[model samples]
Target: MALAFEGKVAAITGGASGIGLATGRALLEGGATVVLVDRDKAALDRLTAELGKNCLAQVTDLLDAESCDAMVPEILERTGRIDILHCNAGSYIGGDLSETNPATIDRMLNLNVNAVMKNVHAVIPHMTERGSGDILVTCSVAGHSAIPWEPVYSASKWAMTSFVQIMRRQMLPHGVRVGQVSPGPVASALLADWPEENLRKAKEAGALLDPSEVADAAIFALSRPRNVTIRDMVVLPSTFDI
Candidate 1:
């Protein structure tokens, strides 16, 4: 079977583990060369070893503007072109707004909001110059609705969702596609940061998605024909009610 991403180059941030790593594997199986970017050097090395030669690991802190700016250029220097940019790097700070300290808040916004925008800003020109590309984001279901447990996290996702909507239109004329996968309750490290009670509830209810499921959504969006765009897909566990 022919895969849509065969011969393409995909750059996925947070690609060391969880949803990002799963997505990288899918892309590799489909014959795409992958560049895996994450902050953990040890994990990046392990993932690169696991994924083999076709996969490259880049240890970077997306919060660093200069580092973010250098990502696409470095990839292009190695691969000659970047066909897909999956903005999947983000953090979840769960708790009441009042409980989130100033540093935590800053870290959350820098990675979740600023880094995404900066990466997009770096890649759009390259994509547009070539007159085609795909930019997919790993959003959350919380972006579509209010999540009472994590107000600031919800705000960050809402911001990203809005960015995808507006950027899709902006890139339409350039033949670039912008889309997002909004997954609900994925059983990943993101959940590890949540309040103990919230995590317990999610686990007990069995309302959790596998990281591979989110990868499936990403591959679907990237595989679409140039004329078609799978703008927003919300993947939730069967038992997920809200």
Candidate 2:
């Protein structure tokens, strides 16, 4: 049986929009307290309020190690507990490696790779101490396959894929479950960065998914019975093949 959400506290990074936002909405429906962490102050605040009393918002730029590290501690203090964490904040950079800027590489790595590691590191001690918790990272199908169009993006997710595997093994003994939700071409703001022609092509081909569908996969992983760990829920539109 899937776990119930009552009284659980979930902190979602990048919770202001896209898959993160969709997950927050679903969790709230299940009666969990949702804390949305995002650097976009306006969107964070607006969505937090719109989500009503069960939701909390924190403005954090995960690129800043200090700000990123401070998130869990502060949230734990306020909420009194953090039962779940969804590391969903990330940026995308596509095209050939030669066409991508070195600075862009650093920025994407800082947010996608470094920040995610730091966030997991910060929360591990607490979750381990409690001997119970759930951590899920938002990953991509690109992490599993080498896509020619987005080398850097692929590299970052591949790094996270490895991290999730190692962390799951380590956290298991402590009773915390670590997993990731991998989705292919979700209909989210992330798609806005794609070339117009490519975006249109994906849509016409029915290769794009709604964020809610991705959110449903995430909820599925989190909702599994504690005795069972749904480590990797790789969701894809039937027509999306890279």
Q: Write the per-residue lDDT of candidate 2 for residues 91-196, one digit (tens) a residue.
A: 9987778887989899999988899999999999999999999999999998899988888999999999999999999999999999999999988878766768
Give lDDT tens digits, candidate 1, residues 206-242: 9899999999999988987789999999999988888
- Candidate lDDT scores, in order, read 0.91, 0.91
Supply candidate 2's per-residue lDDT for 130.
Answer: 94
Query: Residue 162 lDDT in model 2?
Result: 98
Clashes of each: 0, 0
True-structure Cα RMSD, model 2? 1.4
> In model 2, how large is the Cα lDDT of residue 140?
94
Please, what is the TM-score per model? 0.97, 0.97
Candidate 1 at 31: error in angstroms? 0.3
